[model samples]
Target: MRLWQRIFLIGLVLWLATVVVTNWTGNSNLVPTVVLFGSFLVPVTFVVWAYGRGRSPRVTVELLFVAFVVGGALGVLGASLLESWLVHPSIGMYVVVGLIEEGVKLAALMFVTRHMTKRTTMDGVILGATVGFGFAAFESAGYAFNALFTSEGLSLRQLVETEVLRGILAPVGHGLWTAILGGVLFAAAGRLTTTVMLSYLGVSLLHALWDSMNAIAIAVTLALTGHAWQFALLRIGRVPHVTEWQVHVYTLVNWAGLVAISLVALCWLWMTVRSGRRRREILSQ
Candidate 1:
């Protein structure tokens, strides 16, 4: 089997084993192991796959590992610090978050790959995705850790659910967004071109929309079901109890929005990769 396949299979087995042991033994000590495995499994697999795809001379395994660990660490730290200081709960909060997070991921990518002389769009995609996946892995681990605590006590089920959900959506989230930005950045050959700026804004918009999807789905469901009064309740720190039908509608809307966003990002990445390959071919000829 390929490296990515091996990584995913082994990681999944380890995660499952950890979960079973934790459940059987009721050991809180193994919670961290479960969280780390579940959180990092998909991201590590994707990074390995991307690394295989590029197979660039300059982008060695060691460099990719550094980018994944150090770059991801830097991105999450920078984003957390900036978001904590600057962001307030508001309508535009997701937008600000998107801008800040994407900015930081780009910065981390640049910081890690700055010394490389021959940068290409593919290289950027691989490395940027490495950093992004790194961020996702770390951030998901944090989320899983937080999910362990609830109003009552430690909730392993919630932690597993959070990790599973985030793991499933990992590829289309940070990794996809940063891959687009990275492709554009490298296509410009490190220049701050208009194309690069536009790509950043586009990805940031996608990020914002993604972050706000839950709220958007709730609002849309409320509107569709003629529950406009719930909006007022929401404003005054009241969460109106939703009906079964409303819950179904909300879930549908939420998944639909996520699918739409994922499709858009995937298409953008495909086009960007195609364009980059064509450009490279032209240059070679």
Candidate 2:
């Protein structure tokens, strides 16, 4: 009924229609069409949801745009540089990537909000959602592009599949984590305190777990398949043939891990919002 809800519904319908049409026609030309639509669907919906959730003093359109566009671009660029320089094929690589990414996003949040004299927790939530979704959109685009290529050739199906999966998972990923960090950062009122550092570390750990789920699943599968689970397994390409039972077990564990991590992140975000609301209420009293 609200504007954001209506917009999200419309976007969803349009995205579904595009997917149907593109797949029916089997036109490679429409690859980009579906990719962009599907990639933005989840991020946009979550952003609208965040905007509607914070019915308080609204964040300005200009600031939200800067956070979504400029902040997102900066996050991607910074994360890429840090990941390239510091990350390698290792069990711990996901942790490093998570720390770098969440760190850069927080920096981007500060960059966008630095000029403001008064910022509230809600402002951080909305702006943080914008920046996170922006990062999601850009990162999804890159993943979609890469999905087009495979061992065989151009794979439109794979591209669409990648977009859809990432889009579905986008909300609980970057956006949620950043919102938690942003809420804490703003509550700190620019103070470098232990609480802020701990919050950042917590979100970074969530990010690491989210990113490392697949690797963890594989390790578990390998162990069950009688292959000794080693950190080296993570660095190797093309897992040795897994049994059908092992495959099923891995799939179940992988999906469960994903869902568990998402629920944890969502719980953290909900707690942050509740705490922020309480703080505001007490301040007003």
Candidate 3:
């Protein structure tokens, strides 16, 4: 089997084991252990895969570590502060969050690699991924923590379920989005060119769409089921006594939206990589 495939399999197996052990044992201490392992699984797997694929001598272990650790921490810290200060609770908040997060990550990437001169698209991908994954890992931990406690006491099952869902979705979210932006940023040689600006905005919009996917699904569900779309706003804290057919419809649309977003991000990454390769070829000639 391929290296990345092997890594992915190992991560997946370990995650499943962690989930099973934590839930079966109902151990509180094991909850964080499981959360950390599950959260880091896919992001770490993808980072390693990117590293192998790049095979760039420019991307050193120190650099990757710094990018992942420092960059990710800074991105999370900055985004949290800025989001709290700048964003209010509203419909547009998700879009604002995308802007803040993508911007902060880009800034974190810049800050982490400010001294490095020989930057390439591959370096960007690796480092951007490091930052993105770092952000994801921290963010997932927070979400897992929050998911642990509802009105009830510690909910290990809820925590594990949240981690599993986020872990499954992590690769296509922050990591891919930032990688695309980083590729464009490095391809432009750190200049804020039109392409770079547009790429950043485009990725931010995709980020917004991703964060809004559940709401969008709910809206669609309400509309298609002949329910008032405005009632979606009241969905919070109140589980509607919907028909089985409605429930199925909501599930189908939600999963389909998530899949669609994943495909879009993947396609964006593929195009960015292809563009980077072409740029390299032209420069080589």
Candidate 4:
């Protein structure tokens, strides 16, 4: 079996064992283990897979490892600092968040790969994906950890659910976004050209739309169900109880939005990869 396959199987087994042990023993110390393992497993597996698939001869395992660790750390830290200072609760909050997060991840990728004399779109995709997965892993850990604590107390079930959901969605999130950005950045030879800027904006828009999808779904549900007046109640700190049908509609809308966004991102990445390969071929010739 390939290395990524091995990593996924082993990591999945370990994470499951950790979850079982923590739940059986009610040991708080093992909580961190479960959170980290569950959060990092998918991202790590995907990164290894990307490394195996990447054709850039200059990109090495060691560099990918560093990008995954250091680049992810820098992205997370920079995003947190900037978001805390600049973000506020508003209609455009997710948009700002998308901009800040994608910006920082790009910066982190650039920082980690700064010394490379030769760069290619494929290399950027691999390394950018490494950094993005790193960010996703760390960010997922935080979300899982927070899910553990609630008003009622420790919530292992909630934590597990959070991890599972995020794990399932990991590939279509930060990894995909940064992969697109990195391809553009590297295609421009590290310059912030207009094409690169447009790619950044495009990914950031996707990010914002993704983050706001649930709310958008809710709004759509309300409108469809003739409950749009509840928006006023929400504005005034009241959450009007949603009908069962509305809940179903919201779920459908939310998931449909996510699927559409994921499809678009996947298509964009495919085009980017194809363009990169063509560029490489021309250069080689």
Best by the lDDT measure: 4
TM-score of candidate 1 versus the correct structure, residues matched by position: 0.96
**TM-score per candidate:** 0.96, 0.89, 0.89, 0.96
What local distance difference test score does each model get? Answer: 0.93, 0.83, 0.85, 0.94
TM-score of candidate 4 on Cα atoms, chains taken together: 0.96
Tens digits of per-residue lDDT, candidate 1, 203-223, equal 999999999999999889888
Worst lDDT 10-window in candidate 4: 226-235
lDDT per residue as tens, model 3, 44-66: 78887888889887888788888
Give a tens-digit lDDT track for model 2, residues 166-270: 977887889988988888888788555898889889889988998888889987877766455443554585455566888798898899998998888888778
Per-residue lDDT of 161 in model 4? 99
Query: Once model 1 is optimally superposed onto the true structure by TM-score, how far is the C-alpha of residue 243 displaced, in angstroms?
Result: 2.3
Off by over 4 Å in 1: 228-237
Two-way lDDT contest, 2 vs 4, winner: 4
Off by over 4 Å in 3: 1-27, 227-240
For model 1, where is the 10-residue window of minimal lDDT? 226-235
Query: Residue 59 in model 1: shift from native, Å?
Result: 1.1
Evaluated at residue 210, the lDDT of candidate 4 is 98
What's the CA error at residue 196 for candidate 4, in Å? 0.6
Regions of model 4 farther than 4 Å from truth: 228-237
